[model samples]
Target: MVRLSRFVRQTFLSFVAVSCVVASAPSHADGTAGWESVKEAGVLRCGAAVAPPYVMRDPKTGEYSGFFSELCRNFGQNVLKVKVEFVDTTWDNIVAGLQSNKWDLSMALNDTPEREKAISFSAPATDYNVSFVYNRNNPKIAKGAHSIAEIDKPGVTVAVMSGSAQDKAITAVFKQAQIMRLPGNDETRLALMSKRADLLADANTTNMLLTEAHPDWAVAIQPNPPLAQQEVAFGIRKDTPAADIAVLNKYVSEQVSSGAVNRLIKTSVQSMLASNK
Candidate 1:
């Protein structure tokens, strides 16, 4: 009986020792968090595409400033404790940059299935309701046409920003339209204002901003139900460590819940509008 009791005690003690060893070791065995590498590199390479009010880059100064730019700076300074190096990218090639490890984080990116194959997105950072802006005097279609399908007929010029989710969305529903791919919102707006493009289709923010600046145009949005809801978020490579994804998503949710993100958005929009004056 004494020998049996000693054996049982020894086994219990061995189990406790193994548990302690396992618990003391790191959570992951092989890979470090992607942000850990950023910390080690002393700078988080950030992708900033020139989507105004969302991301704006100064060419001469190599400076980035906008809602997403500030938010990324906050993440680098407060969360990662690293400097952020903004790399200018275009609407179409931004996901490619992330997939190729050119940037650690994308400032503001749309979540789509095509992009998901290359990179993973954080929880939604913001939402954009799609709208269509067009010249009221355009003679191609009825002025009373409301639905996108009504304007999807051939010869209707739809100006879309290349490499944008808007480009995809418009192309999907307007198969017969004459789709003109432009580089950015500014150019797309110009196409619509100059009557070269019959329709400027994109997120409400861009369309509304352009409509406000150009009073001659009219916007059509389905008020009872939105035409499309685009969720904008930050993106990282698919192989990014789970811990880093958790940390980034947590930080974004925290900022959103605390209303800081909304306030910053208002400030950025106001700043952009004021500058256009």
Candidate 2:
């Protein structure tokens, strides 16, 4: 009877201990299913479109470089303690890639309502200026237009990258102007350089870097500014658990506050200019 009682008590204690361990295990309430799968695989998949200043491809090594790529690496290496796998994607398919679970997140996208409907965005990591650029040889722009809107008219053609902030804004504000939607960011510059388009609409960093390389193009940035500033953020899937989004947002805020974005812009200008050479 004494042995029976001891065995019963031990069995009950063991069952309770196992139950407690199971109950205390982390779940979707605390962590993300996507992140959990990533952690298990030990690889963080990042979607990259390979746009300059934001995401540049190292021509020789087939490796990725630039501000957004570095930022993604920082998160994967430091925050998640995992290796990163950058998956090639295009801006037009960025949202679709995330929705299909092809990658965990997209890099340095300008957060917008259309994107928000397809996927979620982290808190504003940084903001960028979007402006117009024209070949210095274009006499109309050379006449010194004071306002971005001043250049918008029926005859003016603007070269824009498909599925970009500049593309959307130009379509919205300049109904009379012609928009030539190129396949990618590089093609917009080509269109302007070849005089196929009168103006090139892109982010300031891209315009600055290219202008430095060309010295033949001029930015049409107004002193008081023309367009509203756009927010840059990591693009995550909406189904990602809240904890993952919170982590990304916190890290982005810290990076922004630490002067990382500004530093990156300065460094990228130099590095990208060198790449152009």
Ten residues in a row with the worst lDDT in model 2? 18-27
Model 2 misplaced regions, further than 4 Å: 1-33, 223-225
Report the C-alpha lDDT of model 1 over 169-221, residue by residue, as the tens digit. Answer: 77777778899999887788789878898888887776666667667557554
TM-score of 2: 0.83
lDDT of 2 at 64: 88
Candidate 2 lDDT tens digits, 121-236: 76665676677778767765646775656787778898988987777877777777788998787788889888989988887777777777877555555424546466777898
Model 1 scores a TM of: 0.83
Candidate 1 structure lDDT: 0.73
- Candidate 1 Cα errors over 4 Å, as ranges: 1-33, 59-62, 216-225
